[model samples]
Target: MSSYRIIGLFALLGGLTACERPTPPLAAGQEPAYDLTSYLQEQTARLQQEQPPVLKSVITKGQPTETLQLEELDWEKELAIFQEVDLSRPALRDFYREERHTLPNGSTVSIFTKDAEAAAPVDRLQLTVSPLQKLERLEAVVLEENLLFYSKRNISLTAEPGSGNLNGYRVEGVQKLIFGDSLRYRVDANL
Candidate 1:
């Protein structure tokens, strides 16, 4: 083959490989778990394609509540905090204790609590799945504390009952820094 042709072929192959999605790391001997990263990525793609209108409200300490109707949104930016609660990281494989229970309404709940000795930001994750195996809701609590600052966030996402589409989401949190006043805020959005 000609040198130029070979170089072009190599470049094409590299470009193709770069287009492929990277797989999340998994621990040895561990059963396949829900891929929160991929799930959120898919949701972001779907929302981008659908371009749904969102009703959003924001409240801050000592401030009046602000409401807005948004026709366009940066889904990934909005969900960045939720993505930080990913529990499937290889480092956190055995850090969380998992529990499953079935409710009388035929829904199943799975709870993952971070082990006390494990140094992780996500404190807890709770998921509710319907009888049909569709995700009904997801809730997560994240806490970070250090010598300089401390913050906690309670986040929740709800899916439409039958369609399993994202219906709404809420994030409420408080943050305090050394020598700074505490800040509290809440954000709610409906699609």
Candidate 2:
């Protein structure tokens, strides 16, 4: 190749590299908080490795409650909704306000409430940790509204107080689309 062509290619490559933005680190040191994404990821990995049987019950508007006992589950897919509410992202560092409280029962609670003006879907997240810092329960509310559709989800997860192993989870939500009737659904799963 000609020397000029080689130099131009290098310049183009450098420009392309400069245009690419790397994902910012989740921890920004400005806030002391629990890493929700990492914690959920660890739980997902553990569940997948264990392959525990799950009893799941689902109900949808206008439908009968259906129950299933499954020997295996796609843990990643099942936990996708929880993962979507990641509060640890750098971009969300300032989106939610954190409050810490100590209960009379010797548990600590961390609550993150999103700013009213923030565009993030995660509206609120509350986590209860035992005195030893093990997660006991998590509750979250997520809202998504746009021109075409609207959805609100309330999620709750419970873990064994001593083992910190997830024992059950429930998700309840309502969804509606423009010109359509609202639909409500609920899913409860026990491990």
Top candidate, metric TM-score? 2
Per-model TM values vs. the true structure: 0.80, 0.82
Please give, for residues 1-191, the per-residue lDDT of candidate 2 as tens digits.
Answer: 69999999999999999997675444554345667777788889999999999999999999999999999999989988888777767668678888888899898898899998899999999998888777899999999999999999999989999877788999999999999999999999999
- Colliding pairs, model 2: none
Clash pairs, model 1 backbone: none
Model 1: what TM-score?
A: 0.80
Best by lDDT: 2
| Candidate 1 lDDT by residue in tens digits, 45-116 | 999888899999999999999999999999999888878887767667677887778899998788989999
lDDT of 2: 0.88
Pick out the ten consecutive residues of candidate 1 with the lowest summed lDDT: 24-33
- Global fold similarity of model 2 (TM-score): 0.82
The CA-based lDDT of model 1 is what?
Answer: 0.86
